[model samples]
Target: MTAAQPFVQEGPDWPGLRIFATTRAGGVSAAPYASFNLGAHVGDAPGAVAANRARLRALLPSDPLWLDQVHGTRVADADHEADPAPADAAVTRVPGRVLAIMTADCLPVVIAAPEAGVLAVAHAGWRGLAGGVLENAVAAMGVPPDAGLRAWIGPAIGPLAFEVGDEVRAAFARAAEPPAGAFVPTGGHDAAGAPKWLADLPALAEQRLRAAGVATVVRSNLCTVAGNDRFYSYRKEGVTGRFATLAWLVP
Candidate 1:
């Protein structure tokens, strides 16, 4: 019952590189993740999804090097690779090639070393974030730990709407206790009522980036859960599609 939004941004915050995130708009995908289903592993019609990708590719530097996106810290060398690789993040120094990450609720992060001509994309789904995905990606860039890197977060489940179980809280506790604030206890109750917790994924990611030697970070105020009409949220729908967030250098 809602109208479609457009695929756009005011402008990329990453200088010397092209960076963009896909919205849940302007595509052929129908129903759940209607239009612009950038995720291939999510069970959408391959033909339709490919068509949507083709449409999206028309606006980028080149076909994006997609990832399998396991919730791990593995980083892929997609700089010149032509196929999808099993990794949580991707990095490239080659010009005209794109590195991308997709998510519905999980945070999609874009990293760039403009001076170093390095660009990367990561899927930070708490597991990946806590497991050192950002650190891995930046380290893989070979830019030296002191070389300042910049980053930006794409739309994902915001803190106000993201609730988690004790186990989830425990995961963050193992990584960094300070980020515990990203999670708010729901109160002691059952699984349905047991104290759930709200998570601020962006804040958690920023902390990781800062700790990883990244100095500049830009963030979008978009929340996938609250902006379903503009984003593709798997949590919002039982079987929804995916949108894309990409970054690349122009030849």
Candidate 2:
């Protein structure tokens, strides 16, 4: 692992699995995107994104299955080669085929069921969360109902910084009925004096994962907006790069 190009390794509860979350540090990209922008669609130079990806590829067995994430709940099975599909999540039972999700503020989730020989990752923004991206990914893994699945919630806009309108709050409440603590009404209000609530994305994700039969769930406790020095933040910085969370079976 490159010490300067920061990445956090996920715990080893699921055997035969390797997962990592990269930070904004260490790459060839210049300003705005800066040194280590992994996302190519976010206005970063092609050469810079290529260089950054090539640098990241050194840590994995193969190139990652990059998705054209549309903030929806579609899931792609990464067992075969295909064009970047329109999906928010991906899964694979094949060893060494890396599943990657790029994000700045949206939560990146990595799921593994080593006993079942399956692994998956999702790009879960609020929209994807409300629409069941996590559930879809779990289903796509093809794990039996009795299978033990675990997940790690990666960096995103944290609760304190994620201000939202009543509609956003209502969406989660109406659909999943997540815990009250997941949606905290804050002092901040929009122009119409409508109260802005602080929504805990990780908390909501945990609830959904549990509902979808995941046995264990762990959160990274890293916030892209707050940990700006380490991760990129589209919400905090309008024009920014995207870091990635990658998971695969250890060969």
Candidate 3:
């Protein structure tokens, strides 16, 4: 889609997938959510948000089915493909149907079953991931577990920078296929005699995808916690905005 340009573009490595991750640039949002903030719930002016959506519309193959993401594992049909729905993930077999997922520190995973002519996007924060969001998405596609799904993981908080509590750790462990290193003991030693253990959200996310048979994975390794100018982190900033990673087939 032809809205704000992507910091990274489609590479020769990615086949049968049109994907890009957003940066905090080229939009008209202001203040805490300053510029290019795709999320409307984060308190940006309605007009500016609409204009930003327009920019995204112009660039995508078709109107994107934006989600009212609640950080759950509920997969639903795309807005254009069905009705305006509430779901954390979306998949499509039809061409020109874009499956877009929004994220800041959380990982946004784009899936493509090239042979089956399908694509999907999942918004997986720790809550969703712990609740089987990715597995739900793969199941929603009805592609079978061995369909050779290709995935591209977008920017998110790195494990080293992400600090979580015991509750977050318990959530994953309770999940059927828990990812390892989701959280490390964050209370060893700091430069000034402090205590902390960092989490590796990206690595954990990759492990989840790999466990689900998504062999082809491409990750940007861009950390929202570290990159303030390019990304918006709710954890980093209590009142922050969100960027998006969108994917679709060219008609």
Candidate 4:
């Protein structure tokens, strides 16, 4: 990893597994998508995106299966699927098959059940969370009763920076009541005067992962909105590049 290396390698020290989150630090892109932007659909130059991806590819064992995330609860089978597809999450039991999710402010979650030889990644925004993206990913992993899974929640909009409306709160309630303190009233309102609250995205993700039987859930606690210099932030900049969070089992 050099000063120009784009990834911030972090995750469990488990054997035969590799995980990391990319930063918008080194690449050929310019301006709003300034350098290291991996998302091809975010309006960055196709060639620049490709060049950046090539840089990332050099560091991996195989090409990553990048999903066309739609903020929905669809988990792809990376072991079988060879091409990029429309899904917010992907799981694979095959070693060396990399799974990647691109996000600016949305949560990027990496999950691994080494004993079961399963690895998964998810792109969870509020909508994805309410729609059970995390739950679906964990279910897809199919870890044995005693195998146990551990997850690492990556950079996303922090609690204090992610303001939401009643509908957002209600969405969680309808899906599965969030743990207390997940949403704190901000005592503010949108243009329509609708009540606003600061939602803890990481907390919400941890709650869902635990409910789905993950044994250990760790958070990076890195805020994209706050640390805009290192990570991209769609909420802070409507037109911005996306960073990637990836996971794979060593071959």
Clash count, predicted structure 2: 0
Which runs of model 3 end up more than 4 angstroms from their true locations?
1-13, 79-81, 176-180, 188-197
How does model 2 fare in lDDT? Answer: 0.86
**How many steric clashes does model 1 contain?**
4
Scored by CA lDDT, what does every candidate get? Answer: 0.80, 0.86, 0.76, 0.88
What's the TM-score of every candidate structure?
0.91, 0.93, 0.87, 0.94
Ranking 3 against 4 by lDDT, winner: 4
The predicted structure with the larger lDDT, 1 or 3, is 1
For candidate 3, give the lDDT.
Answer: 0.76
> Who wins the lDDT comparison?
4
lDDT (0-100) at residue 191 of candidate 3?
58
**Candidate 1 segments whose C-alpha is farther than 4 A from its true place:** 1-6, 191-194
- What TM value does model 3 have? 0.87
User: Which candidate comes out best when scored by TM-score?
Assistant: 4
Model 4, 1-251: lDDT tens digits are 45366657476677778988888887888989998999888888999999999999988888989888999999999988887568999999999988999998999999889878899999999999888999999989887646778999998899889989989999988868888899999998888988899999999999898888888899988998874578989889999998899889988
Q: Over the stretch 135-245, how does candidate 3's per-residue lDDT look in tens digits?
A: 888777778767888787788887777886666666666754445555677666545654455677667677778788787777777778874468888888889777888
Angstrom error of the Cα, residue 251, model 2: value is: 2.2
- Model 4: lDDT equals 0.88
Each candidate: RMSD: 3.1, 2.2, 4.0, 2.0
> Whose TM-score is higher: candidate 1's or candidate 4's?
4
lDDT by residue for model 1 over 1-251, one digit each (tens)? Answer: 54244475433555687777878778888777687787778788899787888787777767788788789899989855667567999988899888878888898888888888888889999888888899998888889766668888888899888877767777877877746478887665455665677778899899888888888888887888884578877777769988778878766
Q: In terms of TM-score, how similar is model 2 to the real structure?
A: 0.93
